[model samples]
Target: MLPSAIVSMTEFPLNSNGKIDRKALPAPEFTMERCDKVAYVAPQSPAHITTCEILASLLGVDKVGLDDNFFVLGGHSILAMKAIMAIKQAIGIDINIVNLFEAQSVRELCVLVDAELLRKQLEETEEFEEEGVF
Candidate 1:
């Protein structure tokens, strides 16, 4: 999951001794757009369903929609890596971390997963053909 809100600090908070002060740091503000008009859209395929389930579980949400923004839902970089690993184990596809950052929604991630799966299948087929195993 990505950060929903980012706080920029001009200088590090320091204590009287000139040490970094954790307590003096300002709290980050997190704001997400809430819309009552937005309807929940179900997963369209097995991959989509799996992706949603993984995200929901990782993000500790009751349910995740295809259009839901991961960062807005409290996703962070560490959780993103965890989600990627879970996705790889569940779907047998390696998802690049950068790709995950770029595609922050379940729908977009599913598309990347599908494309990766297709590429893997093609590669396997090509290898098999070269070896005359099929």
Candidate 2:
């Protein structure tokens, strides 16, 4: 995939009752391919939600805000390390204790989860290619 620049519109270029002025509006910052939202990129995966819910359950808490810090929700050093190990093993992420503190809510962690999944998939693909498996 080639990288391309998609310039942001300076203004909405609207008139009257808040409608877009198509003539003044800039062309899409991205091409149709770039604009197309891939199904894999969406955050509707069971793995992510189940993992977060498992953490919340282990913490014995509710309202598990995606940004809620694990420690603040009754997590201790041991528990944090343990959970990190579990997550790494189960989800292929090297989550650190610091990340938990920095990203308290589950929402913030979703980005990390996506990245880890992508990286793991890449690594597997590379391995397969090297082994001439496909």
How high is each candidate's TM-score?
0.72, 0.55
After superposition on all C-alphas, the RMSD of every candidate to the true structure, in Å, is 4.9, 17.3
Residue runs of model 2 more than 4 Å from their true location after superposition = 1-43
Per-candidate clash tally = 2, 9
What is the C-alpha lDDT profile of model 2 across 1-134, one tens digit per residue? Answer: 12345557667888786898877766655343432232222235765675576676777754344545555455676766776777777776776677755665566666677776788799999999999998
- Ten contiguous residues minimizing lDDT sum, candidate 1: 30-39
Q: Whose TM-score is greatest here?
A: 1
Off by over 4 Å in 1: 1-37
TM-score of 2: 0.55
Report the lDDT tens digits of candidate 1 across residue range 1-134.
23455779899989999999989888986433442134678898898899899999998877788888776676778989999999999999999988888985768988998999899999999999999999
Candidate 1 has a TM-score of 0.72
